[model samples]
Every structure is written in structure tokens, then in C-alpha cells.
Target: MEKNLAQKYNHKDVEEGRYDEWVKKGYFTAGDKSKDPFTIVIPPPNVTGILHIGHAWDNTLQDIISRYKRMQGYDMLYLPGMDHAGIATQARVDARLKSEGISRYDIGREKFLERAWQWKEEYAATIRKQWAKLGNSLDYSRERFTMDEGFNDAVRHVFVTLYNEGLIYRGWRIINWDPEARTALSNIEVYYQDDPGKMYYFDYKVEETNEYFTVATTRPETMFGDVCVVVNPEDERFSHLVGKHAVNPANGEAIPIIADSYVDVEFGTGAMKCTPAHDPNDFAIAERHGLEKPICMNPDGTMNALSGEYEGMDRYECRDKLVERIKEEGNLIKIEDITHNVAHSERTHCVIEPYLSEQWFVKMKPLAEDVLKNQNDPDQRINFYPERFSRVFEQWLENIEDWCISRQLWWG
Candidate 1:
């Protein structure tokens, strides 16, 4: 029977029920044992929020490839999943609690986890609905979540295997710390921004001598923890002062004046304070010179007992007070306004501190070596789109640092 053509296309009439029909017919399922298999695991979206334009675009691309493979007679498996998004989900949950005049601590761990699971289910359902609406040919029968029982078991097995292989270990090292979250963060989690700040110049009086060596720093509050002043070993300007002691202007403590090539002679006043616990470079120097790494700030970014009179004060507040005290003591050389790249927490937008901490890390160099070898093997190489990105991937692997995988969050 011939039917009259509609004046305008109605997308709802044309597309509605079409996806359900395909699903019921098992069109997206991969069950032919004799056929060649082609599979794509969708990059899981965070189960913390609703879908956005980006998710639509990404899923559309995956759908196109999956459909093409299916048409090519391959048993295509378009697997779907959602991520528990540890830090991101926790941050959102924390904000929601804050808006309610309550906190995760007030509700306690178990109750907080219940809330997180509720959030996860709500968003996961929304995500599934969005994916179905997009007409993606996903294998719903094989759907998974990152925190599912099988997935959790797989993750535990992998972690245990790595730990047994000596590729995973816990040790004291300098790491990015989110004070607001009270947790250690990986380097990639830190965002760098250029901020207007100051370069403070102060003097370290030579112990039992009439001379003083001018020192400069951006974080004067950490001076209370400084164990030594470092100068370039090749710099004749401070060569004679090596092995001598200098009185700390902030605490009246005698700290050694040491020399190491790591000190940049052109930077600041050709001298740098060794606050090992507060800085990564200083930590390395301390290890080499056998200096003490005293911590000056608590986990919450407040001055610790090591700061004496400034203890319990916020770090920035202590900085202002300590600078004022230094000026009054006649040790302030100068203060220059400047701009510098400061590390900040990507999630909380708070300033990140390079804190000494004990945390688990995955050794990356060995893994990188194996990956590079595989890339060079023609039979095993994974081709990169545009081809030029292969070099970028290789460069990243070559210079990759140890990855910190453990997060201090209740979820995931």
C-alpha cells in the first residue's frame, strides 16, 4: 500500500522504538563463536554527573566504529561501563554535604559510602539512558561498572601481583598534597598557574662571625624548618662559607651553609634554603648531604609545632607574621614583587604543597621499557592515528615518573 509523504520529518516517530527493536533482536550481541572477534571497551565516564556534549561526541565515534565492524561480518562487542571517579565523586559529595551544613565526618565512613553509592546509581542510570538515546550499539548484556564485584576482584589481583613483583612499594617521598582534602596527590593531579607573588630576601648571619650571607626565598614561613643553606659548589662567592654554620633569622637556630652543584647560582641570591620536607629539590639535597628534613606545616596547611610562636597559624598567615618579625630584626634584605608558576590542586583549586609523605607507587621505568620494545616490534605495534602522535606517546613513556595510584577516598 502506498502512503502519502509527510510534509516534515518527525524524529520521534522515526527513531523511537528503533533502538529497542535492535536490542531485542540481539543485533548488538557478539555470540558467533566461528566469526572473528572485534571488541572496543568504552572509556567509562564518571558516575558523578549527567551526560554532556563531549560524552555524546565520544560515544558517537565509538558507535560508528562498532557499527562498521558489525557490518563487516565481525563479531563486534561494544562494551559499556562507568567509573567510580574517586576524587571527583568524593569532592562532589563533600560539597553537597557542606551545602547541607554537615560533613562526611559527621555522617561517618559507612554512612558517607551509602550516600556515594546512591549518587553513583543515580548518575549511572542517567548515563545508560543517555547512551541508549544516542542509538549506540552497545552490548548491554555484557555491561560493567568499575566497582563491580568482578572488576574489583580483577583490580585486587593486579595490585597484589604488582606488589609481589616489586613493582609496587610504599616509601617516603615528596608528593603533591591537597591540604583541603588532607590527602596526597599525584603529580598529574596538580595544575600549574602563574600567580603574582613576592621574592623575599633575608640574611643568615654567620655563626660566631661578624658577616652574614643574604638568602632569598618565596616561602619564608618554611624557614623555621630549614636545616641548611645551599650554594653552588663551583661558585667562588660562597666557597669559603662551606661547612660553616649560619644562624636562622626566624628561629635563632644555627644551620649549616653547604655547597652543591644543584644550587642555581643565577637564581635569587646564589643561596637556597634546604627545607627538605617542604620541597622536592631540597629533599634530594638533604639525602645527599645528610641534612634533617623537618616539617613546618601540618596536613591542613597550618604551621606545626616546629614553627614555635607561629604554630597552629595558617601557612600564609604565618608567612606574613614571620616576614614582619624578620624586618623588625634587621635581617630583611629586600622584597621584590614577581610572578611565578604555582602548583594548585586541580579538584579543589587550592595551592598544592610539596609534602614529604609515605605512599604506594608503581615503578614505571621497567614497564615503559617493555612498552617501547613492543612498539618497535612490527607484529605487536599498535598504530596511532595521524602517526605523528606515536612519537609523543614514546616521549611520554621515556620520561614517565612513578605513578601514585592509591587515593585517600571512601569511594573506589
Candidate 2:
């Protein structure tokens, strides 16, 4: 022990020598069956990352707990790892490629993925070296990457099992789609911006009756996809209008005027346009009322062939054209200036469209039920740090919906 100590207290020399000795002695290794096991699985950080303060804080806390357990005569297995960070890593590589006057599409998916793995290897080594600098007692030998073959197999098995149990399904549903990524993102992956907007009120002529009723909408461009105009069933003024059909001002398509409880009578016009293929709430109303879902826009935010004359136009461009067309046709009742929040893609910073696409989803209700049960149990295995976090967990589990898991990106 005296010989191991350096005459001069040099951190670099002393620490490196000790770490090398520890590694050589297999002190940070695991797989011994002769002791009480205490395992700690690392919350893998994104590989497309630099060691930051947050990473240091998290790893320090984990290391503290792991070391305390080890001192208590437990066989500690604090496994270290990093995630491939699918979308994030791809975005970074794409940006890098763009700087070199090239794009991921130029090299194709296979070549792009090769570059991604190369980037992974380079940064992962940096992350590991940075983690080692902290001298955390981690089992480096048991390191796992999210995209590793064993991890990939585990993920596939779980997905297949869920699918077999009917917990996983595919359907054409309205999702927050990132036009740039060309992928459907989950609700949590989207951020919203509050901006000024106008609510356009247009007259929809009742087919059965010659009388015209005004329906207010924020998106006039999506009118081409409108399948029904809904009103509160309890509203006496529009109760008589139920079972009637109205002509869409944009394309002159005869759409049903249905009455449902989903309509907010206090809101604008007390009438909501049901564009099942575009709006999530409207999609739900359409499903409840059995309405046809006619998509007006493509995945890339361009109007599709179903949009009549507005076809082949960008959504914003179509909005301008539709407004002018509606004004010319004498269907424009009034336009009220309003402010609203719109969802945007977290990665692309592009306006996210509530697009209808066939994608895989996992039923979250059952999973939430299990989580809630575990949370509420008196002898719960996991405990939240702050007691109030338990309530937040409960609230999240209570209001969970089906999670969209599939993305239209080649990276993952």
C-alpha cells in the first residue's frame, strides 16, 4: 500500500494508476454468483452528446447509491451504457452532411446509417472516457447500447408480444406529423407555439333546406376535407337542423349536418367542422358518428388530389387561395382575429400537421392500469423522491391514451 502511493500528489498520475490497477484486478466487473446482488441499470444518455453538468449530477447520484450498497456488503453491478439516440443522432448527422453540401437522401438509407454508426462509435468513446474521468464504480464490461443486437432482440420480442396480445395495432389516425422528418411523433414529442390567427366564419347552405348556417373554423384550407358540420344536440336552435346536409363552400360537396355533444355551444358558431383526416377531436367525432375520412393533404404538408382545385398547393398557400375563393363565392360571413396555440415538431421546428396515417400504436390504458396499481400499493417497490411526484404519476396514468410508436424515418 505504501509503494502504491506517489511521492508527489499528482491527480492525473495517481488516479490513472489506481484506475488501471482496479481494472486489471477485475474490481469493476460482475457475474459472480457468490454474493447478494444489487443491480443498477444506467439511464443511457444520448450518444450524440457531450458530457454536461446534468449528466455529471445524475451519474454522481447513481454512483453514490451504488457505492453505499457496495460498502454494505452487497455485490453491486452498476452497469454503464448509452443510447443510439435514433432521431437526435440522425438530425445531427444530417446537419453535418448539409454542411458538406450533401444530404442523407443523396447517400441513401444504408450509407446514411453507416455514417450514423460511425458517429455513434466516435461519440460513445468520448462519453465513456468522460464517465471514467469521474471514477464512478460502473461495470464497463456489461455496457449496453439501445441498438445493440441483444437489446434490439429484446425490443422486438416485447413489441411482438404486445401485438399478439392486441395491445399493439395499426390504423389511419390523426397524428402530429413532422413534415421535414416525414414521421408521426407522439404528443410528448411536440411543442406548441401561441400565435395570432383568424377565425373564418363561412355560410354552409343546407341541402335539404335553402337556409344557410354559418360554421366557424380556424383552418379554412382543411374545409376541402370536411365531412360533417356538427352542433350541440342540446341546442334548440340547431336541433331542427340535425339530419340535414350542408354543401361545403370549397368544393361544393354535400356533407351531413350532424348534432353531437362534443360541440361547445359557448364557442364560435356553436358548430364544428368534422375533418376526420385532419383534426384529432374531429376524428373522434367522426368515429362516433361513422363519417367518411377523406384526406385533403399529403404527408409532406401539400394538398392531395382529393382537395379539388386546391390540390398540389402547400397548406398555407391553399389557405390563402381558399379564403379568396370563399370571399368571391359570397360564403364568407366574417373573420374574427384570434390567438391560438399550434403544435410544432420538437426536432424539425416545423409546423406539425394533424395528419391521418396508418401507423402502429400501443394501447396505453392497460399499461397505465398496471402502473397505477403499483403506485397505489402500500408496499410499492418504487418510491418517488418528492411525495408530490406520486400525484403527478397518478394523473399521467389516469389520462393516458394510445401511444404512437412507429416513425416514417429510416434512421430507426
Candidate 3:
């Protein structure tokens, strides 16, 4: 054996069959009742695709900890698993079907689900092979899938328990909507980017009087939903305009001029259009003032009946057409080009609409409060590394809103 040493090591020769041997010996399995347990559950990789370098890096760290614990005579159970990845998996399957000139809709629910399961199996096998090649010391005997029977039962049990406890409720609320996906997204799922846009200043004439107050908006399309024009109560310039009604420049509809401190005194002629159904801040103002919230856009981002003649048109298309009409009617004051932040869906990459919809929500504030109390307790405190992260976690928890727990997707 000493006479034939290769200059470069052959990893295949050395590593082949080693992991199988380790598994057969039950080295990575943890069934011992005597030794103290040390477990690390893999943050299940998505079944939508093959694992990448990120997965390798993450697994390597877990593998190191698991091996170290095993060496220290602990009953190590490095559990392995894969996620069904609800939306992500469904998107992948849909894309695949589209390539074959057919859609999931054409195939129907049952057939479409069969394809999704096939995709899961294919990707899960690839991931398992990847983990083996990486020499991860995982307990394959205890492997799990998110959609497995036991996991489904566990999820249902928790959901029902939360519902019974009054922690979960269904109600209408403003949410980030993905038009392309036809689903509601959580706030974190919408990312903002600076986009070159136009600010349109238009005249809102006082009803039954020649007096006019100018208002500016970046989204002229949403003007059809405007319930009121808001000005700061303390602003001397627009104090006289308060309590008067203004004609909506888009359709000559009467909208009240209201005073609210939420309006920025220096921005856009100091007047803000309140579209309660389409804007969160406006919705809050509507709640305080008892103004009606009327939705102007359809779920698919088309103008609805509330948009009048602009109905059935895309929101942006309506904007272009309405702007032209406004200018023709002598209501358009000016247009200024500027860059502003626009929210876009993380998955679909389409512009995210602030949509009002009825959906399931989980009360998160109470849960967050409990977590904060536990974190501050000396006996039960969970330690964080790079300790400054504790403040980041605390800050996020302190401002946590109700979590939207439902999606308009067939999967998950």
C-alpha cells in the first residue's frame, strides 16, 4: 500500500460507501435513552428545486455541530426534511406545464396536484443525494416531509387550537396583493424600489363655487377612489377650504375637503387625496372620519365599476387615459417628474397593490409580548449571538401587526 501513493487524493474512492457504513452502524441515529440528547433539525430545503451553495454552507455548519456532539458521547439526532414550499412549488409546476403548452388550469386540480407531487419527489431525491455527497451526519431514518400525514395532522391541530382560542380571525384589511399571482402577500413579501415616476397636480373645484384647491398625487389612477381631500387643520392656507366639498377632477364627483394632521404641510400643495380602500394611511383617516371606503381596482389590477368609464382597463392604462382627459378638461395644473419608492411582489415581480380583502389573520401582538417577557426573564432567557441582534428582534416584535396566514393558492 505504501508503494502506490497518488499525488492527488481521490475523494470518490475515499468517500464512497462511507456514509452508508455510518448509517448502517446507526452512528447518526439517536435512540439511546441513557445519553443526553443533542439535536439539530435541518431548516427544510424547498422541494421546488435542487440545493445550491447556500444549502451546502448551511448544512456544513449543522453537520459540524452534529458530529462534535456525537464525538462527545451525546445521542445526536440531526433530523433531515424538505418543505412542500406552497407557492414556490406551485409556481414551478405551473411553469413546467406552461412549457408544454398547457396550464395547470387545463389539467384541473387532481392532475395538477399529481404533477406537484412528482416535482416534490424529484427534487427531494436530488436534495438527499446532495446531502449524502456533502457528508452530512443526518438521521435519514427519521427523515420527514412537510406534507406527510403526521405533519399535516400537527398543523391542523395547531390551527384549530389557535382558532378556538380566538387568536385567529377573518376580516377585511389592507394587504399587499400580487395581481399576477392573484394572492395576498405579507408585508415582508413586498420589496420597495425607487422608480422614476410623475407627480400630477390637478385642480379640485369647490362645489357650487368658483373657488379651487389644487391636489397632487403620484397615482392619478387611484383618484377615482378618492373619498376626500385632506389638509392639516393648522395650515392657514387651506383652513378656509375645510368643511367645503370639492369636485373630483377625474369624474366631477363631489368629495369632501377634510382637515387632518397626517397631511404633510410642505408636500404637494399641502393637500392629500384620501383613497381609503387603496391606501393604508387613508384607510385609517377614513375610520376616524367615518368616510366610506370604496374599492376602485379589481383583484387582477383592473379598474372596477367604481372607476366609471375607466372600468376594465389596467390601472396604469387608466392613469394615462385619465391624465389626458383631466388635462383636456382644464383640471390638470402641472406634471413633475420624480423618483419614488414603488412596492413590488417578491415572487411575481409585479407591482404590489395596496388591496382591501377579507382574509384569515393571526393575532401576533399578544404572542410577541409573551416572547418579550420570556426573553427578559433571567430563568428562561434565550441567548442571542452578536448580542445587538436582540435589539433588532425586540424592535420587530414591539411593532408586530396581525399576521396574514391565508393565501389564495390551491397548494398549502
Candidate 4:
């Protein structure tokens, strides 16, 4: 009918014609807010995006609700927007530029940012166009981008206020880092996968006394950052060596072997490597002893200057190289293939790097107390569709990590 009817009749194209009319008539534009205002913030599509079926469904639902509310005489503010999706948006443009023989490095961050803003303006129209087709009553005049001045100011304000209120702090904490995107990601952005890898058993010799103690590790690449060797304080297996040192086979660096009550006595060798910069558990141990964190790899998960012999190699490559070195020294006791969960970035899908960074984190405890203890309000008017989503909302907010809102990318 689309092909045959259009040629036979002068009827305007249904999708485009109606969409243009609605935009011009301003049915979708929100008027001034009254004392009573109703708003359903359409979850902003990431700026690094194209609308898919799921997004379309979401917009359709929101539009229906907004229209219903507008008819009910509520000042409707179905705010439209897009996210400055830091890594995601940057990756999209970067890939598009790769075909043109241009890299982000060639144009620089400033120019790349300009191009990204151009992208936002271009796609923002498509969002409105989609909404119009779905017959949604969105206030296009008030459409906001995540990077808009007011919103960015709000993000900054939240950060500064939280900091002043002692609800936010900077500390050397273990964070999930994206290797390919070179950024710290919130826990929500990480997906876990079971990886098949080997656990290497290396004999650590005391520096002063030639007595040896064995430690098993799945990640030999982090050996360069090993500051201490920890054992269960009550474990009888290695109680004699409580105050001794252990020699890292490949690095020959001596690390104090101490007993900690936190150590699980059953987990291999009853001893673990304390790499403050790498393992979350080790960071706690380091904090207990007031030791410095030495990050062995770059933000991209490549060996940094700290990884002496493997400075230019990938972290995984350094693993193999380090294993070989340990094997030659006769410290390699045994190897076992084991399945373990590894976290990967949601955007890049690359294995995440665990790094100690002084990133910002909010104290969720106080926020939780307020939100949990407060009674459900009839006048507050908070709502979500499908009703089930409210449970998801409550559950998410219940155990939310200190939101790390910073990103390394310049473009969005």
C-alpha cells in the first residue's frame, strides 16, 4: 500500500507528515509548570546511540503515559534527553574515523569533542522524530542533553556537596577498570564470565633464612606488586614463619609473611599474595599495615614502568613471561586448570583491570537510612510502569556503590 497508494493518491506520507504536523502544532511541547506538575523523565538514550526496538518500546510507553497525564490537566514535563555516554560515544566516533585513516590522536581531544557535539545535535532530532511517530506528547523545547550546562552543573554540585557533607571521599580503593576504554566503571557496567585459567604455585623463600613457603596464585602478572604474603593467623600449617619474609621467584623481592585472621585457612597453601594495587583483599591488608600501593599496569592494562622486564608488553603476555621465569627458578610447584569469574567492561567487553585509584565514592549508608525509613508517600507521586520495576529500583538503590561518575574520555 505504501508503494501503490502514494503513487495513485496525493495522501501525505503517514510517518513523516504526521510527525512534522505534531512538532509544528506543539502538542508535544510542555507549557509552564503549574503548582501541580507531573514529570516522567524518559531515560535518556546514550549519546553514542541509535534507537533500537527496545528503546522504541520505552518511548511508546512513556508517550502514552505523558499524553494521558496531559489530558488529566497536569503540567506534563516528559523531558527528553541523551547521555554523554563517555566511552560508548567516543568509541562509536573513533570507529567511524578509523575508516577515514584518522585517529582521535590526530584531531586531538578538543576537535574530537566538537565532532561529538555535532553528533548529538544530529541524532537528537531523530529521537524527536521517533517520539512523534509513536504519538508521544514530549516537551521538545525542554529536551536536555546529559552534558548540558545545567545538568553538568548538577553533577558537579552533587559531587562538591557530598564531599563537604562527608558523604563523599577520595581514597585508594579497588575499582573495576575498563582496559580498552581506559576508564573506571561502575559495578553495574561489569558483566562476569567464567574464565578457564591456571593457578601457579610458586615457592617463596625467606630472604634472611633460606626456609621456603609456597603461595598459589591465578594471576602471576601481579607478582611485581606483591608487598606481603599473608596466612591465616590461627592456621598451624605455617605458624613458625609468621614473622619471616618470602622471596618472589621471578622478581626476587622479599615480602613479609604475616598471619592475618582474614586469611581463609583452606584456600590453597593457606597463603596469598598481598598486591595492594591489584587485589581488593590485599588492599585491605595494605591498609591494615599502612603500606603504599604500587600499580603495576597502565590504565589500558598494559605493563607500566613498574613491570621491569615487561614494560611494553600486554598484562596477559607478561603473565606467560613471568610464569616462564618462575618455572626456570624451580619455584613453580604445580599448575591447575580452574574456572573462575572475570569481570568485563559492558562497552568494550574486554577483561576489566582491577586498579587502586583515588576515585570519588559516596557514602550510601546515610542515603539508605533516609530512603528506607521514609514511609510511602501518597502525595510524592513517584511511579513506574509494570510495577515490577519499582522493586528493581528499590533493590538497586539498596546496595548501590559509591557512584564513580568520572570518565576518562573527552568526547562525552
Residue 158 displacement (Å), model 4: 2.7
Q: What clash pairs does model 3 have?
A: none
Query: Each model's C-alpha lDDT?
Result: 0.91, 0.87, 0.91, 0.81
For 222-284, candidate 4 gives per-residue lDDT tens digits of: 988888888887898888888888887767877788878888988888988889998888898
- Over 186-270, each residue of candidate 2 has an lDDT whose tens digit, in order, gives 9998999998999999998999879988899999888888998999999988988898999999899898888889899989989
lDDT for 237 (candidate 2): 80
> Model 1 segments beyond 4 Å from truth?
1-6, 17-27, 32-36, 380-390
> How far in Å is the alpha carbon of 259 misplaced in model 2?
1.5
In model 2, what are the clashing residue pairs, if there are any? none
Query: In terms of lDDT, which candidate is strongest?
Result: 1
Candidate 3 off by > 4 Å: 1-3, 17-27, 33-35, 98-102
lDDT of 4: 0.81
lDDT of each residue in 297-327, candidate 1, tens digit only: 9998999999999999999999999999999
Q: What TM-score does structure 4 among the candidates reach?
A: 0.86
Candidates sorted on lDDT, descending: 1, 3, 2, 4
Give the higher-lDDT candidate: 1 or 2. Answer: 1
Clashing pairs in 4: 86-412
